[model samples]
Target: MLKIQDLNAFYGKSHVLRGVNMTVERGEVVSLLGRNGVGRSTLCKAVMGLVAPVGHVEFDGKTISGMAPHDIAHAGIGYVPEDRAIFPGLSVLQNLELGMKKKGQTGEKWTLEKVYEWFPRLKEREHTPAEVLSGGEQQMLSMFRALMGDPQCILVDEPTEGLAPKVVADVAAILQQMAKDGLAVLLVEQKLSIALDIADRIYIMGEGEIVFEGTPEDLRNNPEIRKEWLEV
Candidate 1:
């Protein structure tokens, strides 16, 4: 449902993404796995129109390279950054409402009630300030906030960075449920194991380029592919 072809992005004079090509089919979970500084996040940023790139970012079908960030977000895509960007002072419900704004979207499936159903923790702390949430709670809130927009595809950057093992497992479960429920998920994760647990296909990136891609089993069995691009 999303296509990125020959994508090249630069941060001023520093080029971050080099000829990155990948696609996410409807209801499929495809993950981009790589070590630090490999432009994994940059690829997502470019696709979401957060970073300027020189190529094609087609969602459904139309090009959205030069589109505004809000326009891109409103056009059936949701982004959850690696940092889990949340409003510290705002309440959990308040943070969630930020994504509820509907533009040209129709036939929505996610609402505050649905969000509460998916994440009862957010409901429990609905009136508490975001700063009071634990690390896992913050991560949960971030994911649910993106869901509040009712996006067709969601881009998640390292959803299990600093969490405990149990939290990581929870994240994997949530992402897998999203895929099973017919949402295209593009996950960028440093922890290949966590991603492989939920990802249907994997893209191994090295130095801002995709070096290998296959099913989870193919990646697990190839020693050379692990040696070249994934060992950290």
Candidate 2:
């Protein structure tokens, strides 16, 4: 579980996240939807301690606002940034191996074999360099690499961006499976349909603040909110 209260972040003199409040409960998927430059990715960075935050970030009842990124990660939070930051020079297997908190320490929930079972393409390309993989494949690799750490919660920023429809569907299925396996997922996505389909709850952000918080059905019923904050 993760909770953020009165979270504010800045990039030099420019304030990005403005008094944001949100939560992600275990075994649930919460989607944060917004257009470009609405501070969605900044919220993820603030939660991960990559950006300096001016409020509380609690993980499973413990405050973690000012902790180092590595410490935050060791405390059971995983982050997959929008860029799909994988080691291009490393083999797929090696990249996954690097995700482990401790060498040779298998997680109770996620393992290399389980990840491969979920995405067979990864297994087939185990020895191939990560740079050679397709964009969708690279995204999958980035996400599964985070899972290798066996995090209690994951912050996925734009996981489906630039992917084909089928790959986006595959990404959606993986997020659903992660929730079923009891990992809290906080997804920052631009795809409204995908978010509406998989999220238990939705938060729409605009001008660095949350403008709407509701279930998918509530969002569907509120055309005004969609037009004002979500639609392109």
1-232 per-residue lDDT for model 1 (tens digits)? 8999999999999988899899998898998988889999999899988889789889988888899999998898999999899999999988888777654332367777777787788899999999999998999889888887888899999889899998888889889888887889999998878877888999988998999989999988898888878786
TM-score of each: 0.95, 0.99
Reference-based lDDT, each prediction? 0.88, 0.96
Backbone atom clashes (below 3 Å) for every candidate: 0, 0
Error of 1 at 104 (Å): 15
Residue 63 of model 2, lDDT score: 98
TM-score of 1: 0.95
As for candidate 1, its clashing pairs are: none
- Which candidate's TM-score is highest? 2
lDDT agreement of model 1 with the native: 0.88
Which of the numbered candidates is closest to the native, going by highest lDDT?
2
